[model samples]
Target chain A: MERLAFELESAGPPAPRAPPVVVGVVASGNLEVLVEPGDLAGRCRVEVATSANGFAEIWDAVLRDFAARNAVAGLALSVNDAGATPAVVSLRLDQAVEEYLGQRP
Target chain B: MTPGNPGHLPARRSYREATARRRLAGILDPGSFTELLGPSERVTSPHLAGLGLAVAFDDGVVVGRGLLGGRVVLAASQEGGFMGGAVGEVHGAKLVGLLRRAERERPAGVLLLLDSGGVRLQEANAGLVAVSEIMRALLGARAAGVPVVGLIGGGWGCFGGMGIVARCCDALAMSEEGRLGISGPDVIEATKGVEELDAADRALVWRTYGGKHRYLLGEADLLVEDDLAAFRDAAAALLASPRSLDEGALAREHERLARRLADFGGCTDAADVWRAAAVPDPDRLPLLDADAFRRAVAAARGEEP
Candidate 1:
């Protein structure tokens, strides 16, 4: 297995603009995402670097869907993936938001 | 092999013979393990290759999905014979990734068979950060109601950041052959003088750093024989137990460690704490098999060792 890595950082405020928090961790076959508003810019930016070479397209789809859906501004999302299934990757991404930015469990 | 028999890990051999692929076979379940980044991955350290040292595939850590008692558990074990089981950036990432999977699947448990000297000095900065990240993931798993168990079975033991990681686990199972501490004996000896820990004095090293001492002090929860079968059983029993630790238990763990530091006060003689804990014959205690020792000591204290 290749060490497929993908990372994304965005500037500006969420669609509604809110507080900032940092979340995420990188491990084999999984990822921990941290999403919190910061002083980047008005537009959201995402970056992804992975050890897995051929999965970039899959990551693009997932992150694109997330950005389009959330549209939260000024927030940064950093991902360190170790070959996670697309579903698991997205779950952690969504959970990272819930943990650091979203409602309390 | 079982209690009556044994295996010589870190046995004198070539890298292929001393590899974790062979070691983990006996550690985890039979025919249930699927390597995540097996030898074929070739995930060697780009940084280490620059330093001209040999780098193994899987970044020196063997990670996979396996079962203990058929309870589908995520597993990662260090290769002690390889570069003292140090954690590099990719090595650390692999671990956090598995922890993420554990959080997602709520695997019956996650077992990290720790065997490291600490962060790799060659890639020191990233390695240090990675250890901290792994710690956060460990905490997250606990919060998510999944058990994170650290098993110290390697001959090299664990130290530095890895030592802290081992302590943060919900439970730790250790063999007497393993040692856990922030700094290793050689480092301490180099600075504090061999008179302190005496890196060459095998007895003193074991007494100061061995798993038996950790067990008696409650630093290690379950003490098992120095064989794969014993270690495997402890993992299975924990899976069968109620998943997460109750608050009361965590509280007691804190109290025990604090009391130990307060009372022991940086003493070099570990037997002091053992005797104070009412362990009979602290000197001979290290030689006893894990089960016999537990029956003798933990039974008297009415606490899990």
Candidate 2:
């Protein structure tokens, strides 16, 4: 397993009422994401513990893109991945944030 | 899958397809589920990390307390998506703790949503020990007047040591798709060869260990639809009337088993057992739906259909 951590700048923090949210499951080619409130003022911290190794650069790219798309400031995202592809990672990240903001469809 | 939906939907929502959290939400009262060791806690498997395997945040089982029809109850749902919901040290410990709590707290009931392939092969010894501990804890809770009901309808049918644990419950409800058995089909075929039991024969597999056959054999108290609402209603109904584990009950159970052995021990297949049970045209039984099948079984037993 490989561990990766990143902090990215955000536009603003989410609503204060947004409680901790978790989405997805840790299955083969799938992952689970947990989003919680963090102390960061204008940044979001993302940590990943994945079964697939040698993908730090890919993780960085995905996390950066997620931060760019959402205002996830003052939030921490933790991912437990089991060889999920980049597309699945992006989808789970969006789902985690959307669920945190009570916007799950 | 909103938390406060009340779950009276027109469409059939499959319990077998839902995640652990979703299943708990579907059964519990709206907005009443309070997870004890939630995902944010990061209580993952310590052994999986060392083995270079992905570890889940809640260790593949979701344990929590919730309200069922205004009564407080505890529930534990196994996440079959994670390592086939196998019982590891932490996963089994969480369930053990919940059952022990049920003994002390004496909740309305304990719901064990079992969907496991038995012990985790990676954490072999720890997983086996955990299954034993869970069984003891579950029986202990029952002896303390705490009703523990096992529900089986997960993607991975209950097998191995967990099958014994399921039978230890005060009551059990299984969907037609659910299965309860000691050795799984794959395991049997792997050890005894395909001629002994073809794991690829889905029809044979289901007939041998599926909920329908188990229910007909009086192994499951209730055979329900695969829908979540069906499971929820069955659990509620079972919590109202739990089986006693007293000396008389044990004696009766022993007698029942002995009689069964004498009557149908020579049966080679489920069809043969069904024939011995006085089900006319046993080959056609599987084609019937759940309600029709129940009626047929009742007729075979000389009960009102």
Candidate 3:
């Protein structure tokens, strides 16, 4: 298993206050993302645990891009990956954020 | 697929490949499934993340209320793709909660889309306790005159604690591909020598625990094709004329189970069990289709079924 954690600075203010949210399932070629409120000030913290090893740089780039695009400050984003591609990881992150912000009914 | 749109339709799909959400949608009246503790709730398994394992948002089980054939029902479907649909603490709790709701609300029936490999070994003790709680909840629902039906056609055959739980339900609807067994063939072969039970003998495995065998033995209440619509229709019919869990019915079930135990206590061969059941040409039953097999079993029992 591979374990990695990082914190990224967001461009805008923290996201709207809402309850924690989780999205997706962690199966082969799939992943689940968990987003919870945190005392991160204006940053988003991410921790990833994956069954496949040696993709730290790839995960870092994907999470970095996501944090920069979304106003995800003051939140902790955790991912349980099971060999999911970069596209699926990004999709789940977007879904989790949308659910947290109540963008979905 | 949209809420409150009776005309909305989902493309016909095989139940075997459908996801948990899709199964619920296919089984319930279109737009009638109101999920509780949905993925948006973030109610994941705390133990899995702590142990460096993957954690699902709904903890691998989806529980909620839905309308089936214009009747209110509580339903649950296990995500077999997630952790082999193992019953962890939260997963089992969801099922228990649904059954408890059924007991309280007294819905027309409770439908369980079971595709689990039983308790999650990662949280062994908690999973076991949760399964026991679910069993109690199921009995409570039955006592309340709410029929509990189990549908087994997921990727993972029902096994372990869940297998026994399925048997305890008022009725079980199974497909040919589905299996119902206390222990998996591999587990038995590994624990006991190959001479005791060969894991590689696929034919033997199916003949022993497959839907056809169980249906013939009266373990499974209904054997149907592996189509979501077929299962939904069967469930609707069952709820339309629900089974009673009255004193007399319970006594009869008790006698049937006891007789099963007494008849097959020391039996290992599948043929022996069939012969003991007085099924003529027992070797041909397993080769027949589900409908034909059901007819043969009914005929053997001298029933009008």
Interface RMSD of each: 12.0, 0.7, 3.0
Q: Which stretches of candidate 3 lie over 4 Å from their true place?
A: A1-24, A33-49, A60-79, A85-105, B1-12, B261-267, B278-281
Per prediction, fnat is 0.00, 0.94, 0.55
Query: Candidate 1 lDDT, tens digit per residue, B1-305?
Result: 34545773433322122336555666577767788865434576888767644455567687888877767888888876656789999889999889988889898888888889999999999999999999999888878888888888677789999999998788888878888999999999999986667799888888788888888777787887666767777777765653355798778867867887897776658887777677777777877877778877866587675
DockQ of all candidate complexes: 0.02, 0.88, 0.40
**Residue lDDT tens for model 2, A30-79:** 99998988877788988899988999999999888989898888888899
lDDT of each: 0.72, 0.91, 0.86
lDDT of 3 by residue, A48-78 (tens): 8788889999998998899888998889887
My TM-score estimates for the predictions, one after another, are 0.67, 0.95, 0.79
- lDDT at B68, model 1: 77
Candidate 2 local lDDT, residue A54: 97
Q: Indicate the worst ten consecutive residues by lDDT in candidate 3 chain A.
A: A16-25
Residue pairs with backbone atoms closer than 3 Å in model 2 (clashes): none
* Model 1 CAPRI rating: incorrect
**Least accurate 10 contiguous residues by lDDT in model 2 chain B:** B1-10
Candidate 3 docks at the CAPRI level of acceptable
How many residue pairs clash in each candidate at the backbone level?
Answer: 36, 0, 0
